[model samples]
Target chain A: MRFQLTEDQTALRRATRDLLERRFGERERRAAAGGGSLDRALWRTLGDAGFFALCLPERDGGVGLGFPEAVLVFEEAGRALLTGPLIATLRAAGEVPGAASGETVVAAADGWTVEWLAAADVARPDTADAVAVRSVDPLTPLHRVARAARVDPVAVLLTAAEQLGTAVRVCELAVQHARTREQFGRPIGAFQAVQHLCAGLLVRAETARAAVYAAAVTGARTDIAAARLLADEAAVDGARDCLQVHGGMGFTWESEVHLHLKRAWVRAGRGGGGAAAEEALAAALTA
Target chain B: MDLSHTPEDEEFRARLRAWLATALPVLPPPPDPADWPARRARDLGWQRALYDAGYGELHWDASPTTRLIFLEETEAAGAPYVGANFVGLLHAGPTIAAEGTDGQRRRWLPPILRGEEVWCQGFSEPGAGSDLASLRTRARRDGDHYVVDGSKIWTSHAEVADWCELLVRTDPDAPRHRGISWLAMPMDAPGVTVRPLRTLAGSAEFAEVFLDGVRIPVANRVGAENDGWRVTMVTLSFERGTAFVGEVVACRRVLRELAAAARRDGRWDDAVLRRRLGRLNAEFLALWRLTQWNVSEAAAGGGVPGVGGSVFKLRYSHARQDLYDAAADVLGPGALDLDSPWVLDRLSSLSYTIAAGTSQIQRTIVAERMLGLPRGR
Candidate 1:
């Protein structure tokens, strides 16, 4: 009956938040947005810390936890705007052989060609002892040289989880901005228009969180699509609001908020878009 | 994480189902607005049969666990739940149990539990729907009774209800939300009239209840004078809790029906339709979990989670509307024709968003109470 996070989940979240703070701080996030890809050392650090391995069964050398725990981890990741092949790495960790041990990165190689992959140092093409990367989230460092399999709905759910994290992060940034940024001798958060926007962002974040958590618990494919739809909206909209709250700063490369928006836009297209997700949900509801 | 019930509970459910199967015939789905009276009568009969089987008093203190079992069983069976005078049983009954005199409980509880009395809430007037404290209903003490004069709208089941759990201003000079008294007023009293009002769905499920110089016995008073605001809040909490669980389950059934229809029409192949169904399915699942959390929390004697009810209500209502809109969009031309039974189902879903409370009000509640945001000007 308890909705609050368990001790293990709290530890996992705190550890993840601390690691993200140390590895992908505001300066590092700004650096990544400028040109660099996700730091591989940090990726390995998360793997070692068991963030990617949390969802796997205990028999698989993983900490068998539940969706609620996963939610806390992803939410913290979102707060840090820590970008990488998070969805691919997490999914691969659970199902893909040796992927959980940080040996491979799985990606979906459909709808886009896999040519020059970024962050190829930690992962490369055509080396048997090398990384087996699938070309998914091409914008991220998830590309392994192995032949990619067809994308599954599970991948959609993972992506949705990541998006949920990103949305919440953007929401936090927006709230912080509203509280600090001033206009007309008062914080902008005091203004009705700004307050309404922040309120709306909160609503979207909560709704999306509800959807994603439900999907994770039920392990239903339809629920995954639903979560994706909500997460997609939340991320895109939350980032938009973040930019709005930051005014011109949010529009520039110096601000990491737009990076979340871009990444979310790309992820929203992955698996499927709003139209496909909505159709599936509508059918399930009516059926 | 374990949602399953004990074997004893399962046995209780079996007995309830067996009893209901014998005592009541399976009712047809709710009919058109033109056939509402017949539908209402049939529903009332079903409720009576349930009461006879002791299923209607699930929330009553007679057997709290058994009452919970009743709700669980009714929900699992996909049965049309006890619908008549829901406000009475869920809100008024609890309020009386908590604050009413011993005589009040002894006299009122029996009729309410026996299906011998029907009750509607008289809190909202024409000008006092969301801002309920502004209600002008007056209940002046006269002898051993109170002379009540005011009107209450959006009173569901009022036409058939025997009484109303009403809130009235007992002291006009006191501050708003203060000096109010809660009373149990009989509907058939000297100056009471019920006029059915048709909703957008075309059903006259609610009524405008007019009370002019209606006399309520002093014994019928719930709580102390000028303490009605707190009493009303207690009642409203029930409205937001147990009563809401049944409604959410009912909405789930509708969503399931929509899913089935989509599958039947080969709409699953359409990406647009699939996405819509998927989203609705997800939202419904979330609402379902939220309900489970609410029930389990209450059962464990924990306070209701902050604004979680508002979250549930808002999501449920919005998802319901979205489900119907998607149904109509998928049905296309077929939806425009009321002659089609599917169209009627779609029409019924429209009321889900507006009924009980509007989506906007639910959001306001969530914002003001749950989020601790200042009220909108």
Candidate 2:
């Protein structure tokens, strides 16, 4: 009946958080984004630490953990806004062989289009004639892979995990801004308007975190669809709200808040858009 | 985490379901306030039936998992609400069980369990709605009794209640939150009067209660004097109980009904409406999972609720309202008809946002308490 992460899971969370904070803080994150390519060193560091093998099998020379642990690691990755083919690479670990060792970076494909094709050592087997496309999110490199019949739901689930993390991160950012930034000699958080925005974001983030985490554990397509839907909304709208809280500073390129918004906007269209998740939910409910 | 129930819990649920196959009450709450006697009788009869069948004490010492099973099964069986004894069962009974003296528990809890004595809460006043600590309801001591004076508004079921859990200022000179006391007062006491107030939806199930020098024995006090605020807090926390499990079940029912209605009315094909319905359904799923996770967390040794009560209440209220709004979108004018089942629900949903604490206050609680946002100047 208990719903919390276990002591081991909590320890995993703290370690992941500490790693991201020390290795991928604001300056490093922006620099990596500006470089517009994968941080090979950081990626290798994570793989060496078993970040990519949390859900893999011990028999396969990887940690024998579960989806709960996998999502915990992804939650940190999302918070750090870690770039490149992490999701695709993790998914490919059990499929493409070399991916498990961080020696091969597999660019994730969503139907015909893929992300970070230029940065990957390997691409999904189905992708062909990949062509680079200008990306809206500075942190992600987009490519148009040849049209394919399928988009993996696991890919969507991973994107949903990132969205959940970003949602929580933006909520923290909003609260931090609201408490420290003042208007008319009071913290902006003292205003009901700002309070409600922060509160709403907190609810959305917490709610989506629950959904996404449960979906990971349950491995139910319907639950995953709902999680993706909610995480998308939370992250996208939460970033907008956080930007509002930061006022003019948030609009500046120097502020990391806009990066959150850009990433959310880009992620909202990835794996599967709102319409796809909506169809899955509608089918489940109507059927 | 596992969401499935233990075998024993499943068996407990199955037994209740089997009993409810025939024992569950079917009387829809009457629209007419005048029909309250029949309604009250039916509600009590249903409660007594469950009591005799071993549900009255089901929650007294039950695990969170077991209590959730009870609520889920009861909601599934369409069992009637404890009706006029809602306050007694949900708030007062638990408060008595937790804070009452042994004699008070024995004296007060059984009737409540058996549905023999209905209860109402005397907490809100015209001047003290959100700022409840500022209530002017005075309870002055006068030789072994407290002479109570002042009024309370929005006291639901006051007209039908046999007793009330009253909060009053026992010391005007003391700090606002420190001077209060909680008491169990017989509703028929001298100088006690109840005037029914019709809600905007036109249900007279709530009332305004006045006590003009109503003399209640000091023995009625539940906790020590000047500690009433803590008692009141204990009572408020009980509002976030297993009832949320039932609500999730009920919500699924209504959502299915609304979807079916949308299909029959040919509105299901409306892309905008379909998208909205889909989003709302997803939102409901998230909320349900959140609650289930909360229950599972509590069962796994999480502490009793804190600001979470406000958070869930606030979120669930909005979800319910959003559902009804989507219903209206599905049914259009059909939802506006007063005779439509959903019309009453849609009209009544607004009160949820206002009652207990307004949505505004709820947001404040979540911001200041849960998120640690700065308090307003």
Docking class of 1: acceptable
Error of 1 at B256 (Å): 4.6
Which TM-score value belongs to model 1? 0.84
For model 1, the local distance difference test gives 0.69
Candidate 2 residue B249 C-alpha distance from true site, Å: 1.2
| Model 2, residue A271: C-alpha shift (Å) | 2.4
lDDT of each candidate versus the true structure: 0.69, 0.83
Residue-level lDDT of model 1, residues B29-100, one tens digit each, is: 665545645545655666666777766567655333345567656776766665665766787888888888
DockQ (C-alpha) of model 2?
Answer: 0.68
Clashing pairs in 2: A1-B296, A2-B296, A3-B296, A3-B297
Error of 1 at B365 (Å): 2.7
lDDT of 2 by residue, A1-287 (tens): 55678889899989999988988888888787776778888888888888776667999878888877877788788878888788888888877776877877887677556878888888776567778888888888887765653667777888888898899999999999898887899899999899999989988888898789888878898888899998998999999999999999999988899889988887887754678788677766787
Cα lDDT tens digits for candidate 1, A1-287: 34334577677778888888898887777666554455667677778888788789999898887766776777677666677656556766756765676555443342222222354322222333234344332334433334443446765676677788888788777877877777777777666666667666766777777677667767776767778777888888888887898898898866777778877776776643566666666655554
Give a tens-digit lDDT track for model 2, residues B249-300: 7888788787788888788878788777777778888887888777776677
Number of the top-ranking candidate, with DockQ as the measure: 2
Q: What is the interface RMSD of each candidate, in Å?
A: 4.1, 1.6
Best by lDDT: 2
Model 2 CA deviation exceeding 4 Å by range: A129-131, A145-149, B25-34
